[model samples]
Target: MGKPGFERAHHVAFFDAMATELPGDYDKQEVNHLTLSYFALGGLSLLRELDRVNKDEIARWVLSFQVHPEAHTDVDSGLFYGFCGSRSTQFPLSNVKDPCHNGSHLASTYSALAILKIVGYDLANVDSKALLQSMKKLQQPDGSFMPIHIGAETDLRFVYCAAAICSMLDDWTGMDKLKAKEYILNCQSYDGGFGMVPGSESHGGGTFCAVAALHLMGFIQVDLASNLNDSASIDMRMLLEWCLQRQVNDGGFQGRRNKASDTCYAFWVGGVLKIIGAYHLIDRCALREFLLTCQSPYGGFTKFPFDRIPDIYHSYYGLAALSLLEEEGLEPLSVELGILSSAL
Candidate 1:
């Protein structure tokens, strides 16, 4: 393919189709249907075409995934009352708090709240008391968050979700800001990039999670790019170097060093630069050309330029990356909260 265009119409139809029903290719993602739906709805938001979907109906469906405590005191039963990922994981509204069985997830809760916000639903209307109270329990002594209530991985991804949730709700009671900040600082590698956890290799996604979470939590006082001297917690200069280096020759970004350029990192790494106010330094023309090559003719975007089929995750990020470039006819993306500004 010789430079396939943005295919805005096809991309619109792609997200529009995904909003209603998922194809069989996403069978493994049934558990993450809400998150998947977020990609579609959020994708549409970035494209300035949210009116294509039914906001009220989608809001009702999203709310149904929220797990509720049967009693007010049950919030202390060590169970998370956030939204479950999907119907299959959702048990019949139980406060059981089984270490073996729990439905609600940090990522799912983030997606559900994000979807609600995207569709113009009032976050004040949500059951904040139970959700926030239990969300606190998900934070570990180290300040990283487990996606689920108990016995799950704790890393920067869930940390970003937690930060986004609290910021969206306009409340920080769900987590301790200083503690989360410490955990995030610990994840930053000597190279100035952040890993998913301490001692891991630096990655683009982890870097974004750490940086964006810190920004949402109000840890990055003022544009660090222009005022790096005041920063003591993170190596701002090294971080900026690490991020700018991610943009490969193809103009797309790779999640890590020595990896091939990917579509998602265009958003993952691109988002970090945007948040730090260094987005102006990248090769925008080269990046857009690379992203256009990844756009699927049928609809959506692929991870690589040569791939023909497109997935929802990469497709959403590709559009988001383009939004950062200020592409014509797209809504501005908030690189911090992982949702479009139009949604907020």
Candidate 2:
């Protein structure tokens, strides 16, 4: 068979189906429905097939998950007045007196805002003052963020989410920039890759979260692979090398040391390289071939190449990786924002 090309029409149909309603397998993830939609909607946007979705309806659906405080003063009640993951988590304000039980999440907030922008919703109407003011409550003294105000992990992931949320809203008040920067800086592994938290093993997702968070927070400069400036906070040379070494013989990128190449890492690792301006160094032909193997014949991508089924998460990152590679007919992405450039 000829070299597998970007199955544009099939992929569009794939995301279109998911956008209409996610498959039953995802029912267990009902709480994260908005996040799943971001992946599908983002995939459709990458394929230049956004016309398939109704912008107003999707925007309203996403907005419905947002949790606003009862009053402006409630921003200080230590509750996160951000977006919840889905309808189930959207607790009534009357029943949400406990900050810990409030269903709004940092990650969901990021996804909610992304979907809003994807649908061209006017975020100016969003309760920025409340969202930003309350989001600060989720930040710890160490500068990391918990996904929720309650029992949740604080790591580079939520930090990135918060940073993206603030960046999208065109306001930095949502997070303390200096503290977040310090927290992100502490995550860098000695090998030059970043971990989810200080003293953890380097990971592809964590590295992307750290780098992209730094980019959004203005702690690091872009295209460091080409510019090579001394003013950079992290070990630039080592960071670039660590990112470059992720491409294995199969041409797909791996998440961590000695791991199998996964579909999502293509975007996770490749996005870091792109931000550092080192993408031109990749084995483009081989990487494309590797990613094509993961393309599910039914549409979308799977974490592994031989997997039978497709998942919205891997599928979205697959398109994201292709967008980073500038694949023909796909929309370019804002790497840090994780959305269409036009959407911004």
Candidate 3:
């Protein structure tokens, strides 16, 4: 288990923001999408602040986004459409007032699904077969995945999303496993990490996605390890050594050598190490000081040291990184991680 890093004061303050049911100032315009909402709730749920909020109301709202199979335009298409935004924007206006049926996104689908699982909902309600069928359509021959429908941009992020979806549905037949695995393996740089695309600079976030996907798909051993002995080893000694060595005096983690660390990279690289079974290598005392300093006094968290513009995205990830370190009486998501790991 990871140890606590920062004080309880930070935890209580962050939890309070999550508990406050603020008016929907941003929901209609910006926060209406299920993906951002899911990221927000992920922070709250993983932090155990879900109890402080209305569980029934939130659960119902999340379930409402589920795309019933009947709504799909074609059975062969097997895609889910709809985005959850309130009545705010009149631009890109569709004939239908409701936004859910207008668009579909791979990122949104994965986040929406993850938020449901985080909230303890049963998977029985999900149309797994239809989702798998839709997933196959997005799979490119190169193994990268398009965002939702065909002709969308093919990239590493979508590849990770596709892998996560398959892992969640417990089916790989929907995707070309060999092609996807080959794509991930091909992206590995000379530095032994992955980039957003092949032959590009390595990034911690991209590395995490590639590694986590391979690990989830039962292919990490072959790619990350050298041989059978390395396959059985999950201690992450070597991997942690590489990741931890990337840390500077600050709490953040840098993707490349000698580069300054970013608050977000802390979670990406740190979270990856946690998955590799070596999160304990993080210096909790030092890292906590760095992360807490990044927190804005009004609420929310930021990147770098001593920055003030707090955002939901960085705030959520900052909390997650600290959770990995088990700081501030916060519990890590052992249950969810355990369930996902065992299934692989």
* Per-model TM-score on C-alpha atoms: 0.96, 0.96, 0.79
Per-residue C-alpha lDDT of model 2 across residues 1-344, encoded as one tens digit per residue: 67777888879989999988888999899988888989989999999888987899888788888887665445787878888998888778677565467789998999999989988998998888989998998999999998887758899999999999999999998889889988988999999999999999999999999888888877666655334774247887888889889999999999998899999999999998887777788888888888988999988999988687999999999989988888998999999899999988
How do the residues 77-126 of candidate 3 rate in per-residue lDDT, one tens digit apiece?
A: 53444222322311233355653343456676676667666766666667
Native-vs-model 3 lDDT? 0.63
Could you tell me the lDDT of residue 91 within candidate 1?
Answer: 77
Model 3 weakest 10-residue run by lDDT: 335-344
Model 3 bad stretches (over 4 Å): 1-32, 71-73, 78-102, 221-242, 256-258, 334-344
Candidate 1 accuracy as lDDT: 0.88
Model 1 TM-score is 0.96
Tell me the RMSD of model 1 versus the true structure. Answer: 1.7
